[model samples]
Target: MYSFTGNGNPTLVGQLSLAAGGIGLNVSQDGKYVCVGGVASANLYVYSINYINTTATQALSNSIVFGNSALGSNYDLNVRGLSGAQIEIDGLVNYDNVN
Candidate 1:
């Protein structure tokens, strides 16, 4: 995922992989971690993002992990960028736990 302030610029902000059985996902207020949910059940899974390298051929950008338990009923997961935000690929959404 990427984010921009106001102009149509691209900022590789974060990346997320759907849990094996996750459906919906969202970020916390501070943007430090992600909250995921299932499709048929009401469960929220928390994940943390990690950044390794800044300059390199294979620079480590973002990393995440599905939390232990699900936290809320699952819903459709959609990726939406801010004024200048964009995402490569959105994950699957429905009603299930993937962590």
Candidate 2:
């Protein structure tokens, strides 16, 4: 992820190893946190942002895994709240067997 200042200079805030598939990203209303969803890995990651001296730093705060089931080809993530305390994730899953 990157952060842009008023002068339009971009700075590397953080980075994560995402799966080889489409990924979803959302930022909190307060810009204090961000959530990312990995479609291929079926996992979610939350990061906290700290700013100092016009530089931003991101730290992994939490992670949630949704088993190995193959999530569909698309995913969407939405975060809302005063401090981004609420998160809603939706996605399509592919199921090959049912018994």
Candidate 3:
């Protein structure tokens, strides 16, 4: 990931890894989630971004040609929220929620 400043130069935020060669990627509109569609390993990795990216979940069990994903992790008051994932593979779409 890279951060952009007014100078128009991009600064490296950090580097993360995927299980296989990345073929497709998407960042959430809110900038909190990142997705990587990979070949070989054929897994869609969903990462939750705060300061460091954590593997929230993995989806799509095939050599993905193209894909997208979402992840959520949050807390407030004394309640803890569950993490979830949504993915759309080459042709099949699936939504999964985890607690």
User: How does each model score on TM-score?
Assistant: 0.32, 0.32, 0.28
Candidate 3 residue runs with Cα over 4 Å from true position: 1-22, 51-99
lDDT tens string, model 3, 1-99? 555567978665444455445455666655655666667767675564443223556643433112122333231112122355454446433333322
Error of 3 at 25 (Å): 1.6
**lDDT tens readout by residue for model 1, 1-99:** 455469888666454555666565666545666756675676555555332324555533433322322543343233345575456544322223342
lDDT of 1 at 66: 27
Better of 1 and 3 by TM-score: 1
After superposition, the stretches of candidate 1 with alpha carbons farther than 4 Å from their true spots are: 1-22, 54-86, 89-99
Give the Cα lDDT of each candidate. 0.48, 0.50, 0.46
TM-score of 2: 0.32
User: For model 2, what is the error of residue 16's alpha carbon versus the real structure, in angstroms, after optimal superposition?
Assistant: 16
Query: How well does candidate 2 match the true structure, expressed as C-alpha RMSD?
Result: 16.4
Candidate 2 per-residue C-alpha lDDT over 1-93 given as tens digits, one digit per residue, 9 for 90 to 100:
556567877666545555569676766655655768887878887665443232335522333322222334333222334464564645332
